[model samples]
Target chain A: MSASPHAAGSTETRQVYLFATCVIDLFAPQAGVDVVEVLERLGVTVHFPAAQTCCGQPAYTTGFPEEARKVAAAQLDLFPEPWPVIVPSGSCGGMLKQHWPRLFADDPARRVQAESIAARTVEFTDYLVNTLGFRLDAPAASGAPLRVALHTSCSARREMGTLGCGRALLERLPGVERVEHGHEAECCGFGGTFSVKHPEISAAMAADKLDALTASGCESFVSADCGCLLNLNLSLEKRGAALRGQHIASLVRARMDGAAS
Target chain B: MSAASLPQADARVSPEDFKQRSHESLHDAHLRQSFRGAMDFLVERRALQFPDLQAFNTLRKLGENVRQHALAQLPDLLERLEARLTELGVAVHWAETPADANRIFLDIARRHAATLMVKGKSMVSEEIGLNHEMAAHGVECIETDMGEYILQLDGDRPSHIIMPAIHKTKEDVAAIFHEHIDGAPLSDDVNELIAIGRRALREKFASAKIGVSGVNFMVAETGTLALVENEGNGRLCTSVPDVHVAITGLEKVVDRLEHVLPLYALLPKSATGQAVTTYLNLITGPRRAGEKDGPREMHLILLDNGRTQAYREARFRATLQCIRCGACMNHCPVYTRVGGLSYGTTYPGPIGAIISPHLMGLQSTRDLPTASSLCGACGDVCPVGIPIPDMLMKLREAGRHSVAESITPPAQALVGQGSVRRAGEVLAWRAWRVLYSHAALYRLFAWLAPRLRWLTPAWQGGWTASRAALKPAPRSLREQLARRRAGRTVPGR
Candidate 1:
């Protein structure tokens, strides 16, 4: 495997560790597979530690700091080595990079481990665009006729600055056109535990996302985060709307495979 | 009238009522759609500007310290600020209420023989009903902030704290401008819309006898007033008019310029995601000698209006530390979902929910506290680390206590235990004991008896008629657990 998408005839491949988020692990394993495949194809050694578990975001968001610490400690123990731990989901990645250090501040041992992990943690799109400088390889199609709207997850857009990367990757996809939605940066209301705690707010925010998506007249919606996609999809289902939501990786993977055969 | 004879008001909505209203508002299709879109825009824009939370937090801490230090010595600083302003030939007035503040400004305008007042964006002005009060006295106050200008033309209150007309779409703004601006061609372009406002307000700025503005921070050391804005209209408003008047909350003051930097860093980022507002106009003692532009006469009105009360309460003092950057509203799940109009107050969202009740009184704005879901997102995002959720709970308690005090003794007795023995009476009452022990049977009776008028008392039936009781499951969880412990299958299973 080459170290990067641009790396050709390489003598050495960079080692990349995958932190398959809980949602991806249980619900959408294909997203994890897509991540691994994309990384491996881009000339990187992919490692998936079987011991990896939840990022403790669920516990932390729910105000259970003690339970969150336990989960964070376990994650720290699992990823002891210093390698870039690229995560597909920005929410989980944010928990590791931003929240874990704060969660373990009282414990010196855990804090040190969390800090080390945070230093190496990066969201997948950000890693590809910033670190690897993986420019979009495909050209915009002249006239295949597709209009795609992008819904940026709160974690990806707010916690992580992956908006440019998400947009860039989408704009490069063949036969796809981009339409900017008003209030595109707003939360889809899928704030992890917030969805269950305040389902009303979550549902309201999701409905707002769907409205913007529908207003854009986009055939399909693309987002970088799966949690957003799932919540948005649920909102769409509730309203009996027929709009498709896809992860950026899924779209990229499909694009790479030449229009889904 | 005596306090007891002030005309008893109905009890504000209960927490249960607020929850139901919030739930309905959240699921409302149009509301949800609009909120999601608005939140996404703010979140994306903010992230692009401030990518590092650690850096943001550091700046936020510094800002908090500055506010806290200033608040600690507020009396001394206010005196010092007055002395400096007086030395510069500017008048300073202290107003204890909205009426006092409004009267003070109107009196200043009257003394200046003012006709048209060129006003910049000031939430305090809104708080005191300055425009309405001035208008009632036949004074025209034209808003200079572009967002405020649009809302003023459309005759609407500000919807968002920083972005006042955030609820208005480009088309809505275009229509409002076209209708109000004497046949100016309507355009959806924001810059074009601003240009239209600029042209319309240019005459007002030049000919206006008096100008009114809001200070983001008031520095005590040099008696300098700071106004941060993107439009530069604040500068125009302060400089162009012959007389300039600033009305601001007393909480806006700081000890010195040294304390203003961290706040400068945090305010813009939290408000509009800008590294810095386009204009940070620092006016020290009005215009110095030989100045070409700036007010010949300057006045700063520091309005307290319940801030002293808030500052006295240890639990609520942190509220005074709010710089009003409005990040709390911007990131609030409830605020975005329900929109600002639902808040029914000048300040909206998580911050408003906590502060409005205290400022407006518990009875007037009691619904504010119950609007939150206790999601804790607002507390996390607060730059000053204001425990918004905790404060909200306290406000709810205050509301309940106020309600209990005001109601008839019989009504109050229904909610409260009159004496120490009454508590035991409540717990040991056979009906109440049975209701507690058998949750399922209690819920079933509650649901079924609402339909049977003969079985329940008029008061209890009236309460049930007004609000639906909780639907009980066939089997209680405790009963199911007990059956499971006995190694028997439950009926439902």
Candidate 2:
């Protein structure tokens, strides 16, 4: 946990900034805590700038880019440069790495700053596998592995390419097993505001996702995006379904603590 | 193919109103299953076609270049096409509106004293309501494509462009044929049904004085019109009858014959995943005096319903590049789930979502733009490289500002638009925009959400409609982190 894994300077001690997006800040704080624990255990010093807020995805995806730009433009200043910004949620990582640079396209000065931020940002799972080179050490399954379903968020697949990293992280755990399901590539229909805007279709799609997850015979689920986790967990709880979903960080941390749920 | 549940089977077939159609389609188990199977097959087939990534990209780039070049010189190409067509003795007509186009067709039919007209599956015809217009003039417009023929007999509009009868199962088609066609034996075998339809349609093709078809590509270099199909109906519509009348949107024009190749190559493949359709007919002119078997007279009717509206905006012209391949819908999660009937437009799926608003205007189609999950699958599969998700978002912004027409009584806004404005939503987002832009207020709002979680569902639109409850967590990460930082005296993480 002592040797610095990455940085341009290779100073032997590397520090990283955590952009715990608004969703993690509000709806699922435990996921943020688990992210910190995981990174600290890997010997990376994690710093959270209290001034940091959201990645402005709600407004950006909702057809209000102008309103989104106001928040997105301001976020570029929260973290100073060259820390390799790590995000727990791929949706927010997409907003930072993929969406923010586009927001400042018309302005040269801000666009440079935005691109710099985007270049250094990485989703936690992707960083864990690619940069840190930390392999999972499985002790033993003790006869039965804990079956957990994994939901790959849409942005995570498209922007971050973190599905591999998430799977690789899960593969390292002693008793944790990643379960496969039909229609895994299809969206879970929790498209932020789209769920509320078209609730009938949203609920129908969520029910279908649940059908696939439960059919896989997994007792619980974990996803990189809290947006999907929130929507899926709410539906599961509402239906009084036996299956539950947590953010991948919490699931991994919980597995490290000897339980899946 | 599965049969729909008996009670609500026939309840919501029309798309005159999108919301009602979407509501009923989501509840229609039969329709859902039918679309699911058809789309899955189409998506898998399309993926298999371009297994070589480098070749696929090459083909896509070529298609995009051809489309962009043609669109850049559309007016000049159309004039050149008209001149070449005049020299070739193929009558070319310009129709400004749907009424004009239909009138031209009826006049052509009357000139030949045509009573029966066999047609290829033409979506443009559906858009202009040409069959209904022809029927009013005592002309029997018989659809030759098996899918179109089934829907024609059922008096239902096309649900999808390439596969018009996809919403109907073999059993549904069997029931329709048995009910509508006299002495028809009930059969669920697709080949048997196709044979029956071919037998019935073949009888009319010979006796009909005029044939109607839609043009896939209008080649300006040689004034040639290309028709692509699987059932061989398009060839019959253009060649079997003495007088051939072809209809298309103005945007289908190509400057050179070679320019049409890349598009024609991708059209069928993107549609049904075939390397090539069974028929690819290119008609240059009418039958010469010594020619064996072709149309005696040929006419091209270019309809400009709302294409110009799209052309006026630089960004919107991307929609015109589409070849009507239906690949977008095949990969579209939303369209596959709800089916095309829910779109209630001539074009359905992602293309329809962007194009219908311009054709029908923002007044009636405000909800169409918001129907997608913005997963970008439609954009990914588009052959001509139309960024449909970008256009969808652009249209959504346009809808928010477009003047609201007085909605008729009893038809409230589906989500939020028209006469019924979502005042709370406007305030909620506006307040959010203000708060999130400032770090302090953003933290304050995030902290307040969990404590006042009960108030969310009320303002959350329809998110809680089916669920028992939807709530936020008890604490914010900032508070938790602050607590840890205070207690440990050393930022642990």
Candidate 3:
């Protein structure tokens, strides 16, 4: 609709079908809103199809495959192919793109459709850097650079293999400084039903994640998965720790708004 | 020593014990720190072994192929192995269960009137509760491996398969030795501790009536047993005594000698990151008629235990491909934090999580499958390319009858297989399926959940315990989308 700021911005029409994950849809609506706004500000049309509900990760990871198939099959017709289906969370994005075909492996015809959807689905930050090619070269800032750490969820790190894309996003934010924690490869322990089944071990792992992030000397945190956000943010509150984790979409949108001025 | 006189474990593993152990382990600051340091060292050592990911994956493919092919022809290879070993003057015994294996060992020791028995690092022996059984029969058994010896002195089970005493620090080992050793003082210096261990075991090796060790790989084509070790004590346990008994599960056999080379390269590099361990002893047979050293008689015990059960099923057959490297546990976040004893199983961590279910049945090991975070770190690091996370999911499914029946149906109901079932938990999952299946119900629940956010339950297990209240937003995203499309000025906007 509008010309993008990129020097080599393509003249072809672009659109992003938003798959606002279940965790963000119910728990943190602001993440979904921020994701849509950041994409809109980049001169791309963002569509939030009302028929979409969830990507069915909660039951799938918790050893309920039949239930997962029922829920994941509902998403096949919600968005047509050719347009990239951008997802806010890497965990959900991986479920749609990487694991959907696994759920439909028993059937050949549905598996083809699942693979087609998987090829077009992209996580928000990955689409931001790799597809859109949006770059920030010392963009305008509203205040001093905010020191923050990034907590990459295990699903995002190992399953989706998108940590490099997450890093590229952090590097593009001119006013946002990224700090690396020691145990970056470890899980935050909010493993779907695992957090509910084994509480003590989950709390211990969350405490370790917080300690590593706190020790890295960051004011706050940003993560790609809302499951980690809900767990870590709550754990931080329980301990009365000043640290809080925001969705990466919120961080990127806020920095983009300041750059627009 | 008859089968009627066989003794079971004094304190059998129970599912309730695991819950208690995990609670205690999570609270123990000392145990947590020790496991953290030890696991970090192990993981770092293993990472240095595979700087090239492609090369590592290629080697894993070869290892997996060898194991799958070996298991495909297990019965034929085993028969070949017995004939070859018999020709080499080695006694080959077949055991169908832990009780049978123990009885065979005790009968052999009694025939020799063995008083003192020396042992190397053998997880199979621990799996069958052999040390305690031998001690009950009035045979003095001493653990010869340093880690096993320390655990024996401390009256503890081996926490890790490869590094049994890894949970103990230098100071902890020193204190354990100072309490148990009947000798001069040894400081915290590791070399001094090794010397003390070496000196204490040497006399036992010289005077022991029999020695026992674990086999890493038993070549079926030539009937040679390959023992991989870094301590050099395995060589002593197999060669120093008048009689040597090398015990291992039937899954340890490979088709040919060359099939063992890929696994040998994988085990040490995965266990302790050595290009080749200090000792790679291949025992083909007993000492010849005029040999100056080595055992006078050698016995190889092929214990089935529960491997035959696993080998019969295609779903769990991949579990038999393990090489006892312990890399899976080293990379597991849960095992490292909770330590090994919390599992209350002979083998702990990822491999234990998958294998113990088949060996001991699902009733006792129900908690092991749920212990992981499903991080896939262990699966990624497995040298033989065992899909550990996928296997963990299978165990979780088999642990519950309601879920397993729903997936596989009642016509093909799993028989003789043990599973742990909870009625209330089944009702919960049933409710979950009902809620997620229908979009209208999901939307209605989403609409009400946020408005009733204050009524969020505080008793959501670990969720609300250490985190803030999980209150949903006042409005759903679909609600916002509808208002925006209708040309309404959203309050936030």
Candidate 4:
């Protein structure tokens, strides 16, 4: 989306294309809505093309190269403009920004389109902090601060190199205190389809992740990707833990709108 | 366990068992606490020094190009290196496997009439299980590297690449030294610990008839073997003995000194947060007649093992770019927390996870590919820009296919027949939907699903284990759209 909440110009007025990820589309539509609301509040005009489908990450990761190429071709055709594609989910954004070029190696036309799109695509938090130069409003040291734990999704932390951005932004929210989770960068075991394919190993990994999260002693947890949040929430809920989960965008929006006390 | 009493197969643990054991072992309160402390220390130390090392990307690119260029010209460089070493009166040997490499080294030892062999830190030797092999052949082998020597005394495999004894606390080292070193005063003081290791290895360095060491880099231009180490053991192991043997992977060859300089700069910085190690020894075919301290007779064993096979494949050839800096392992979230013993390979962490399956075969290490969360941190922190995550995925595909092929007769029959029948049903279902209205048939099938629980397999049943309960969608998309057009709420709502 556009820059920070307090930028000189109206970021909400700027035009942004929302790349609604397939997982969010099918499972967690509220995350996509939250992204739109956050962007609009920051003064950005959001556009969601109905023609947008899957980012081909499912097929691509499953080793179906031919099917992935078909999906990439359709995606390239669907998003033809040069405007920045703001992706709400880190995994989809990472796939489009980093992996699309490798998907269509033989086709020159699609490869060029993939490269152009990748250059303009940005993860939501990184775009807000780096591109928009958003300065965080430091919360006053008053009242009881809510302890929050941060999890950096694998794609966003390692692929995008924004390991600290989410935590940095969360610390700025009023009445929120960020606690470091042990093995915070470890996988949440939500690797798409990996959970279903190898449920034993996947569940074991999720248990380890939950243990680390619980060790942080934070009542609420936040992560950069919706997929990780969903997997983590499911695990927590299954264990009957009352830990709250929220996306960083929603937290920032809440702070901006003065909804969080 | 004593060296003589140790079981042979215990050294080679199966990957499945390794994963289960590591998962169990990592949960130990003491081990987890120690690992957390060590990982935090390394991460903080590394972060402070390279807070914004902008040139890291450039260095990685250069390292990648240099390695690729070296691998492309490997045959020519090997020939030239052999020729130059021959000119200097040194022998060169090539071995394709651990047995062959060990036989070559033992043959040299036998020819020299050597009873004692002093060794520096050599991961290749570890890969081949050379230490136990040498001991089995009645040749007493002593580890000269301080970390290696401590691990040797503790009767354990290395747990970290650069820092082999990283898992051991100071108290562990003290206990090890107290047990092994006869009448030697033991202390946990870091310098005293160093002194104990130095005192123990000094006698081996002087009395050993032959020396063995691993090459950090090999310069093809001058036939030089470069050994980089923080301790001076590598220097002693390469120079003090009458007969010296240097073993290295074929992938270690570089074109010239200039190409290795940038790598040398990046290696120590990334590995240990040091600008340079204590010693960077370059031996050009061992000792000349005028040289006083160097070994009189030198031998170079360039072992291929499985490296050449990996190098030939374009997709995996990037793995050869690894300089063994251990930076990837240091930063890896999985490797850091679980420790290296969990990997059950000579090289541990991200690099090992990718390359070991190729070298050891997919069937043996099927579990390693699934070890990662596919975090891509290894690729980012790699000094040589290896696409480690991509390689791991490829390994996973290979593992899955291998597993599918290896399924038992009954399992295979069930899967084979079920898949074909399912395929036909799916095709027929799609065809029927396109040709006619199948809304009633779909509703009937959906209604019967919950009653027919026996049709689902255990793995599929496990998929819904976390869900509150499985429930069918109220209406199809087309029906929902029609309902919206009529301005009526859907049935589920």
What is residue B335's positional error in candidate 4, in angstroms? 1.6
Winner by TM-score between candidate 2 and candidate 1: 2
Docking class of 2: medium
Candidate 3 runs further than 4 Å off = A1-9, A141-143, A259-261, B1-10, B13-15, B402-406, B409-418, B488-493
Ranking by TM-score: 3, 2, 4, 1
lDDT of 4: 0.71
Better of 2 and 3 by lDDT: 3
Could you estimate the TM-score for every candidate? Answer: 0.59, 0.92, 0.94, 0.82
- Candidate 1: stretches off by over 4 Å: A1-261, B1-32, B402-493
Model 3 CA lDDT for position B341: 82
- TM-score, chain B, predicted structure 4: 0.83
Order the candidates by lDDT, highest first — what do you get? 3, 2, 4, 1
Which regions in candidate 4 have their CA more than 4 angstroms from the true location? A1-16, A40-53, A62-67, A70-76, A80-83, A126-150, A161-189, A193-219, A252-258, B1-9, B184-193, B398-493
Give the TM-score comparing model 1 with the true structure, all chains together. Answer: 0.59
Expressed as tens digits, the lDDT of each residue in B1-493 for candidate 1 is 1112211212232333444556666556675566658766776677777788898778777877888899888888889889988998889999999999989988988888886798999999988877777777777788899988888777777767888887778899999888878767979998898888899889888889998999999988988899999988999999989889999998888999888888888788777778888899999877778977788889999888777767766757788888888878877767876777666677888888776755666665655665554545676667677778667755544443333332111222211222112233223333433432343554454345434534334332211222222223333322332344367354321
Quality of candidate 4's docking, in CAPRI categories? incorrect
Q: Compared with the true structure, what per-residue lDDT tens digits does model 1 show for residues A139-251?
A: 43223446888876766665666778777766655567789886675677666645654555555566666888899988888876777776776567656678878777776
- lDDT (tens digit, per residue) of candidate 3 on B271-318: 887788999999999899888999999899999877776787687789
For each candidate, the alpha-carbon lDDT, in order, equals: 0.70, 0.81, 0.82, 0.71
Q: What total of clashing residue pairs does each candidate reach?
A: 13, 0, 2, 6
Error of 1 at A75 (Å): 31
Model 4, B7-81: lDDT tens digits are 332466555465666666556667766766776676666556566667777776888888888988888988888
